[model samples]
Target chain A: MSRIEGRFKQLAMQGRTVLIPYIVAGDPAQDVTVPLMHQLVESGADMIELGVAFSDPMAEGPVIQLAHERALASHTSLSSVLTMVQVFRETDATTPVLLMGYANPVMHMGYAAFADAAGAAGVDGLITVDIPPEEVDGINSELQRVGIDNIFLVAPTTPEERIAQIAARASGFIYYVSLKGVTGAGNLDTKEVASRLKLIRKHSDLPVAVGFGIKDAASAAAVATVADGVVVGSALVDTLAQAFAGGGDQAVALGSAGKLLKQIHQGIANAAS
Target chain B: MTRNTEENIFATVPDEQGRYGVYGGKYVSETLMAALAELESVYRMLSVDPDFQRQLDEDLTHYVGRPSPLYEASRWSDNIGGARIFLKREDLNHTGAHKINNTIGQALLAKHMGKKRVIAETGAGQHGVATATIAARLGLECLVFMGEEDIRRQALNVYRMKLLGAEVIPVTSGSRTLTDAMNEAMRDWVTNVDDTFYCIGTVAGPHPYPLLVRDFQCVIGREARAQSLNQVGRLPDALVACVGGGSNAIGLFHPFLEDSEVAMYGVEAGGHGISTDQHAAPLTAGSPGVLHGNRTYLMQDSDGQIMETHSVSAGLDYPGVGPEHSWLKDLGRVNYVVADDDEALRAFHTLTRVEGIMPALETSHALAYAETLAAQMTPQQMIIVNLSGRGDKDIHTVAEIDGIEF
Candidate 1:
């Protein structure tokens, strides 16, 4: 099984919801990314979402967009993101690393070349925000051949018919956008999320990881009820941005982000118990 | 002057998934796929719906001032001393441009689809003004995204849009031009898909958009065609139109795609010149890449980073054209040309002085191209130039360039 599918299965058996913390690789600093990947695991992350910074991230909100800008300012590229995954893999082999970003950078690297490099770097999956399943020809099969999960997003507006179509090729848990807006735009409506997840479940056996509007421990915990995994992006990225902006020292900022992740972890576990 | 047959492929295009020979597709974020699909279905239903057509026609005739005259520019043609020139007077349309045609058609579709709000991105502010006018007419809320740079350049248009009840939000993103405005508009659509209808200004974006915008603006071609048949004994020997995101050019070219005898030219904005890195002529200076949700020729570097494009006219400052234009370029059907800022300015002044008509800088690109092409052809031949807009909005830019202030 792919690392993502395996992790989801393991979490399912344990009756535990997966906590996925998204951090932009090379955000604020290049060396900080690998360390942050390790820090996420220590803070009880089930999987690591390493954002590959691109010039234009259409699906992103202001927080994530700023994160992308910071990462790109640090001169981060696809190769650099893969190298971070490699460094993280040296210490942690069990945790799956999903590279999340727009499709242009990956397309620039060429599908076969990127897939090969990603596999070699021990990357587990990819979330190309701009590449819908209908336009997945060049990269999807190539990524799958190298054992990388091609994760697709299912939105609140996604109809049942398209949900089934997306579910067919999707792996490593579908990222269900909790709201009908960009990340960090507004609050999540858990009841609406639950209804959407129900529809998504009818089409795929894969785990559903809810994201896009999950802000804090309460929101993440509420989403963990119906979702198999919870993704917190803008909030975590915002935390990193605060640290990089001299709001506090690196250790304090990282520790505080870890503290927040720990709270989210406990909240989900508390709900399950 | 030599080219292969365009292969009756217009009918077979955008197969099941809205692709044009591996060009156009749903290369958008997954959240937008459902919305695009829903739009495609609605458009498909309304495409042949006679009720929808009747409403659209009524609005076009009485509201937008459709069947805009095909004026034979006798004075300008006599001055050029070449081909007899005809101007497809889209400038005479309500709101002073052809943009109202697409905006009105889309606004009607927005009403038909029960959307309560409409949003659009603008560079020249013509599309935004057109959209806001229709939205106000239909009682739908309207929002327009304009780049900070463009809002400053086209301040008159910004005021006009505001007067028409559109909230003109300034986009302060990369380059801060039409491309950035489009990005902001896409974000808005993704954010408010429930009540918002994105009235895209041109023939770009993912799937049904290029097709939808083209069909709406084809009223230009349809009218010009019938008008030419009645005015002249035969079709014009050559057709010319300016291309930004290429809505106007595609609108005028799509109906004539099958007319093998008619030659077509699409003018791109040559900001400085093709040799310099300052121009926005993507078809001539750039290669194929994906941007703004569709695969097309792009002003992007090797790293897939979109390059900053330049143009004297804000409307022609985009780094990409519509996907269908890319397809047509590959097929060698339409001859894509360029008009540098200097040449377009010359055409702008010449038309204003010789014919007493001030054309939009965007439309002047076509006029500039047609002037040169007409100077070579015989007077017996005819060329129809799609005069896409009026220059009242551009008078400030022109005045500033001439070292005069209001």
Candidate 2:
């Protein structure tokens, strides 16, 4: 099993819910990002999902889009993001890092080079927003060869046959989109997510992480009850945005990250109890 | 260059990297690298699936009003005093433009991917209207990103999209037009990459979209090929069409690319003149640069920043041509030229008066170039132009220019 799967399994054995914190890498600035990522893990994050910034991020809402703009202004390329991952791994290597983003940049870099670089940077898995199961054959083989997990997404709209296809191709874990709209646009429907997870469970033995509108501790608690982990992004990005807007203080930004992750982790612990 | 193949025109010229010539390659930020790779895999699987092809054909035929009429413009031909001219009337398709052909195919792909939300960017609003229409039909929540300037200019299309149950979001960034709207739409796709599908309006963007849109719009060329052969007893001597991102031009030219005997011309919008900065003729004046998602001929300065383009026609105001068209120009398969604002205006009025067909300002550029080209050709020569869209949406702009509003 991969490191992420091993970590999740260990958490499951301890009756603890996995808290996955997501952030757009280079958002605000690269200097601040590595420290912030470390802060999230130090506080309570079990896994880290580092978002790769794309110029045209079709599925993002305004907040994350602004975050991407900030990162782009800093000229954050995929290589730069991998460097950040490498820097993080220097201090802490056990926590699994999943690079999440769209598919265009990877295609531009060529798949083999990307897989090698990502694996070298200590990236455990990948979650591309647009790639479906039908197209995973070549890339999946390449990633598997590099010992990197090629994660798949299963939405509420996914048909049973497609779910089975995705389950078969997916590795590390499956990401369950909580709603139909862009991130931060709509409220998450816990009952609907629970039912979707139940359906996904029948197809894949992989752990499923629910995301897209898991805003606060309550929503995280709700998702933890049904999902293997809860992925929080926009809310954490919003916290960082607020902190940055006030002033460029590392302590303030790190404090906010710690507070947000602690709240969600506490909620997850309480729910499990 | 294989002469005969069971596969369609798209299967003929695959790029060295497995792309569709130079048209379909992923050019995006590093963040989107993984996602695009995954999407490319899914697209390949679905492209050859018999079930997918069958379903797509059914939707195109029954839903999108396929096999659009091939009407010979008798009056216009007589006025030109030369060879007969035929129009493959894609404007008569559902949503009043050729945009639906692409939207329907993309919406289906979105459904197959289990995406429940559809998003699109529009300049003239025809694409937005079409995307919204299909999204509603497919029971998917639709969101359209339009530049603030476009929303003000294409008010009717905005209302139409909203009436069709889509939320129109006005983008106020960059140049505050189609490109900005496109940027916003891409941003949205990146954030919600898992559950949302972006229905690009034209034959542009990164790999898959340019190829995919061209494939969907290929119905125009496929039908016209048979119709012209049946009506005129042979193929036309020349095929002419406008090139706003070159979707319509590609749709018409693709089927005829291998026909060495048939000449093809793509009319670019020379807003004022090619020498001036106020034009959308990317192939004529711009160099190859990567923007949005793919590297293609783009109107940019020496500094590489995308330059602002001006055109009377909102639809043709974009600063880039589709990547496939760029490749075709280099390969010498099709001739790319430009038509100025005055020439297009004259052609627009002439077609409305002589043929009683109010052509869109974008299409008028093609007609304008055809008129000039026809003057130089013999009476025996013939031309086939793709009437990509109707002029109804452009009536207001025409009236404003002529100082006579309805």
Candidate 3:
């Protein structure tokens, strides 16, 4: 089984909700990412998403957009992000690490070549933000050939027919954007999320992960009850931004990120799975 | 290179996925796919709907001042001592530019769809002003995204949009130009998909946008085609228009695509020169790349980052061209060329002095090229140039460049 499937299956047996904490790799410093990836796993992250910085990240809101700019300023490219994953893989093999970002970098690298490089770099899954389910068949086959999970996102505006379509093609888990806006732009309506997750569950057995507006531990816990996984991205990225702005070094930023991830993990753990 | 492919050139376009020979696709986020799909369906229904066509046609006639004149530049042609040059006076349209054509159509569609607000992105502010005027007329809340640099350069047009009650948002992003404004507008559309309709200014963008915008703008070419036969006693031997996102050019070219006799030219802004890396002539100097929701030719660096483009004309200061234009280039149906800043400026002056018409700097590029093309052709032959907009918005830029105070 794929790392994402195995991890989700393991968490299902343990009756635990999975916490997927995302961080743009090589943000504060290049050398700090592998250590941060390890720290996230240590802090009870079920899986980690390593964001490869692109010049234009349209799906992301201001917080994550700033994180991307910071990461890009340090010359953190897709290859560097993969190298970070490769380094993290030397110590831990079971924890899933998904490379997530826009499609242009992959297009620049060529899909087959990128799939091979990502597979060689120990990437378990990928979430190309701009490519939707309809446009992913070629990339999906290429990634699937090398055992990489193709994760797809379903938006609030996505119709029922499209939700079924996305669930059918999706291999890892469905990232249900809890709000209609870009990531980190608005607040999540948990009541609306719970109602939508039921609709998604009716279509497929694939685990659904709710993201895009989960701000604090309280929001994470509420979403964790309805979702198989909870992804806290902009919140963690915002914390890292704060730490760095406060003259905290990369070490301090990663530590703050780790502490927030742990608290969010704890919140998810406390929720009824 | 392949002339035999003409049979299927315009027949099987878009092919259900909105691709024009692998040049266009929905290269957007999942958050926008449904909206696009919804828009495509709505467009498919309404584009052929009699009532929608009636409403749109009525607005084009009464509101937008359509069937804009096809005036022959007799004195300018005589001075050039060559081909008889005719001008499609799109500058005479409502809001002082060709932009009102597409805005009125989209605003009507937005009204029909029950959308309460419309958003647009502009560089020269002509489009933003036109969209704002239509929104004010249709009772929809309007917001226009223009780059900070563009707002500074085109302050008068910016003030005109404000007078129409549209919220002008100055995007302070990369390059602070039209491309950045477009990015911001796309972001806003994704964020507020429930109530706002994106009234795209050009024929570029993802799917139904290129298709729909071209449909709205093609009235220019359709009218020009009939006007040519009526006035010139025959169709013009050649057609020329300035290409930015290529809405105006495509509008004038689509009706002539099958008229194999009518040679077409699309003039891109060569700010300095293509060789110097300071131009916006993507079709002339760029390789194919995907940007802003479609695959097209773009002025991108080796790493796929869109390059900063330069043009004296803010309207044509874009790194990418429309996908249809890209397809047209590959098919060899339309020849893409460039006119540098100085050349466009000279045409700006030449037209004002000879024809008593002040062309927008964007249209002046086409005027500049038409001068050379007409110079080469016989007086018996005719060349029609699309005067895409009036130059009043560019007067300050022209005056400042000449070191003249207001």
Candidate 4:
């Protein structure tokens, strides 16, 4: 089994919903990323969705867009992001690390080459936001050959036909965009998410992970009840951005980020799985 | 205006999946796939619908002033002293550009789809003004996303869009140019896919957009083809147009693709020069890459990050060209050339003095190449240049360049 699948299975047996916390690989600074990844794991993050910055991040709202900009400003390329993943993998071999971003960067590094590099760097899954199943065959097969799971997003607007299509192509868990808007948008509407998860369950046996508007402990807990996993992205990035920008040193930023992740992790742990 | 027969190999491109020889696809987020599918289905149904065609045809004639004159530039032709030259006056169309052709078509689609709101992205503000004009006429809410830098450069056109009751949102990310505006517009569309229609201004974007926009703008080549036969007693030997996102160039070239004898040239902005890394000449100096939702020729850095592009014309200051243009370049059907800012500016002055017609800087790029191309051919041969837009919107830019403030 893949690292992601194994992690989900372990969490399922423990009757705990998984918490996936995302961070841009080079946000704030490059040197801080590896240490931050270790900190996130220590704070009870079940998985990590490492964002690889692209020049244009269309799916992101203001907060995450700024995070991408910050990451890009540090001269972080896809190659550099892969290197960061390699460093983070040095001590933490069990935690699943999924790379999430747009397609152009991955396309820049040829699919076969990117898959090989990402696999060597210990990336367990990938979530290329712009590439749907229809356009993912080239990269999917390459990733599959390397034993990397291809994760996909199921938006509220996605039809049942497309859901089945995505489900057939998808491995790992399905990321359900909780809102009809970009990341950092508010109003979770857990009731609507519950209904959509039921529909997605009909199409795929894969676990459904809800994302896009889980801001705090309460929101995370609310989604943890309906989802197999909860992905906290823009909210967590926003916290780290503020922490780094407010700055004392690397330790200060990591501490603040760890604090927030722990709170949400506790909320998920306490929720009724 | 007749379409090329099905037997014409060039006539059946972009296949049903919107692939123009592997250069175009719906490389967008899944949040947008359903909407694109719906748009494609509706557009397909309405394209053959008699009532929809009638309405669009009537609007083109009465509202946009179709059959914009094809004027023979005898004096300019004599100055070049090689080939006879003609100008397709797209500058004379309503809203002062060819952008209105696509906007009008898409606004009608918005109405047909029962969308109460329409959004667009613009660089020179011409498309914004055109979209705003149609939105006002159709009683649809209009929103235009423009780069902060573009808003400052094209202030007059921005005011025109505002006067037409469209909300102009200034995008402040990623070099603050047309590419960024497009990115912001995509974000808005993804956020409000249900009630809003994103009326793309050019022959770029994802699948249906390129196909739809090109079809709407094809009236240019169709009209020019008939006019060429009637006025010149034959088809012109060559066709030339400026290519930014390549809508106008593709519009003028699509109907002539099957005419194996007729050659075509697309002039890209060379900025200072392609060698200096400042130009926007994607087809000339760029490599094939995916950008702005389609696989196309793009000006990108080694890391696949889109690079900032520079051009005197805001409309042509883009890092990527339309996917169809990339396909044509690869197929060697059209010659992609470059006209630097200096050459385009000289062409602007030449056309104004020689033909008593001032062309937009974007159009001037084509005029520059047409001059050189005409100079190479015999006087018996003819070249038709697409005057894509008027110079009225560019007067301020010219004045600033001359170090004259008014």
Q: After superposition, how far is residue B358 of candidate 4 from its true place, in Å?
A: 1.3
Compare candidates 1 and 4 on TM-score and give the better one.
Answer: 4
The model with the greatest DockQ is 4
For B1-406, candidate 4 gives per-residue lDDT tens digits of 2444558767667888788998889889888999999999999999999999999999999999998999999999998899999999999999999999999999989999999999999999999999999999999999999999999899999999999999999999988989999999999999999999999999999999999999999999999999999987899899999999999999999989988789999999999999999899999999887777899999988888889999999999999989999999998999999999999999999999988899999999999999999999999999999999999989999999989999
Model 2 segments more than 4 A misplaced: B1-121, B127-145, B155-169, B172-233, B245-247, B250-260, B266-313, B317-359, B364-379, B390-406
Which residue pairs in candidate 3 have backbone atoms (N, alpha carbon, C) closer than 3 angstroms, thus clashing? none
DockQ of each: 0.66, 0.09, 0.59, 0.84
Model number 1 iRMSD: 1.3
Give the clashing pairs for model 1: none
Let me know the TM-score candidate 2 reaches against the reference structure: 0.72
Q: Which stretches of candidate 1 lie over 4 Å from their true place?
A: A247-252, B1-7
Comparing chain B with the reference, what is the TM-score for each candidate?
A: 0.98, 0.94, 0.98, 0.98
**For each of the candidates, what fraction of the native contacts does it recover?**
0.64, 0.10, 0.49, 0.76
Minimal lDDT window, size 10, model 3 chain B: B1-10
Model 2: per-residue Cα lDDT over A229-264, one tens digit each: 899999999999898898858888889879998999
Give me candidate 4's TM-score against the actual structure.
Answer: 0.99
Measured over the true interface residues after superposition, the C-alpha RMSD of each candidate is 1.3, 7.7, 1.5, 0.8
**Which predicted model would earn the best TM-score?**
4
- Model 1, B1-406: lDDT tens per residue? 2222755677788788888886887788777887888889999999999999998999999998888999999999998899999999999999999999898888878898899999999999999999999999989999999999999999999999999988999988778899989988989999999889999989999989999999999999988888998889688899999999999999898888888889999999999998999999999888887788888898877666678899999999999889999999998989999999999999999999988889999999999999999999999999999999999999999999999988
**What is the CA-based DockQ of model 1?**
0.66
Residue B29, candidate 1: alpha-carbon lDDT: 79
Enumerate residue pairs that collide in model 4. Answer: none
